[model samples]
Target: MPKVVLLFTGKRKSGKDYVVSKLKEMLKPEDCSIIRLSAPLKKQYSIEHNLDYDRLLDSSPYKEAHRLQMIQWGERKRESDPGYFCRLATEEEDKPVWLVSDCRRLSDVEYFKSHCSTGPAHPSCVLVRVSASDEVRRSRGWGWVGGVDDGPSECALDEVSCDYHVINNGIDEQLDMKLKELKNFIEYNNNG
Candidate 1:
């Protein structure tokens, strides 16, 4: 049982969590474990800052001002010590497919690729990018502060590329279709 890690990022309320939840339902919890890298950091930050964890994590101010640095530091920490994300992935011990949601840095992807590339325990990973308008995201109380400039900046585009791009413009049906297509692709390749 190899793994399928779904890497994604977008403004808060852009359906990253909702979409991942839907995928989990479709795939079943036994077959997959959806994990986020920033989740722990978000918890710690919230505790230190006295902010709601959900709101702080979804806030645009957090993303715009600190996500990059936090992600970079996380990557360095992981490199120096390999068990950071790996431990979380293996904690459940069910060998369920690991859906690594909220994978933001190139180093994060690189770590997974290096560790899960071989053996029966190997992971079949698929990178997915979720996108949506800031207005839509903000209205949902996602805390998008950057306004219209929230789309991936040029640096982001160059830094991270996805195997699949899903524009989450508020159509549940369409999102289902995209996730289905990704599932089909993963199944096809893994079988082959």
Candidate 2:
């Protein structure tokens, strides 16, 4: 069973990956594992589309070029199975703390919520949104794609409420403080 689950959702180049990496470093010796939901989806998408999985996984011009097409393909798969990638990502996760680092839709969070938490009153799963400004993301090499930036896969959880909203512009003191508190939260809940 998942002792503590953090469902993370964010836009492209929103420091979601970077923040999760920090969480991994901070959750030390506590059996924390980061699950990128897109990994399995991208692998399947790459196989079916005859694309290079390695290239698709990287943050390169190659990935940006194929982002729209992949989003379309992913939407088709998600329509058929919303929880497909979620389940695949967590299949081998044996750790007590799970950080789902790339949740793109409401369904993704809902899937983990159902699987991780026993009841609503004593919820074990936490939804976290890591966001960086468009200017900041652009500085970090993020350019908007038409279909992908505007589509359901990327925009589905934008308006939803999250337990924690982290603004990761430059890992300033405020962001560091929040992360510290989050680490404490995870450790307390994971071993309590």
Candidate 3:
């Protein structure tokens, strides 16, 4: 079991991936693993739709074209089982530290918190929110999509409390400070 599970949530282009990557760099790579909840969703979506799964995983036009449909499909799956994707993402995980790169809903947070709270090797589950201005996200290729940006997956955690919040608007100093704090928290938990 992991010593810590960082459950991250953010808008589409809010730099969740970037921040997670930075965190990974700050930690020992062999002791940590990055988990994307979207991986299983995209894999299933690809098989069902006969699309290339690899393409769907990339930040490319192919992914953009299918993003809405994929989101809808994932929502349906989540409705039937809130922890389906969460379970899939961590089913084979054995790392000491897990950086869950994308957590979109309150259900996702609950799933991790509940599961990580009980075992003998239970880890400290930390909820982290990453945010960027509309202008910054737009500059990073985030355009407002009706059913996507305005959907529950994007807005569900808007009012949710988080243990840590990262404002990633491309300011180096500010981002570094937030990330350093998060790193220190993780280290403290791991050592405690």
Tens-digit lDDT track for model 1 on 24-67? 77764556677777776666655765656776466556555665
Overall local distance difference test of candidate 3: 0.90
Residue runs of model 1 more than 4 Å from their true location after superposition: 43-86, 118-123, 142-159, 188-192
Give the count of colliding residue pairs in each prediction.
1, 0, 0
| lDDT (10s digit) by residue, model 3, range 71-164 | 9999999999999999999999998788999999988999988877544453489889999999999999889889999998899998898879
What are the lDDT scores of the predictions, listed in order?
A: 0.62, 0.87, 0.90
Candidate 2: TM-score?
0.96
Question: Which candidate number has the best TM-score?
Answer: 2
Question: Against the hidden reference, what TM-scores do the models get?
Answer: 0.67, 0.96, 0.95
RMSD of each: 5.0, 1.2, 2.1
Descending-TM-score candidate ranking: 2, 3, 1
Q: Which ten-residue region of model 3 has the weakest summed lDDT?
A: 114-123
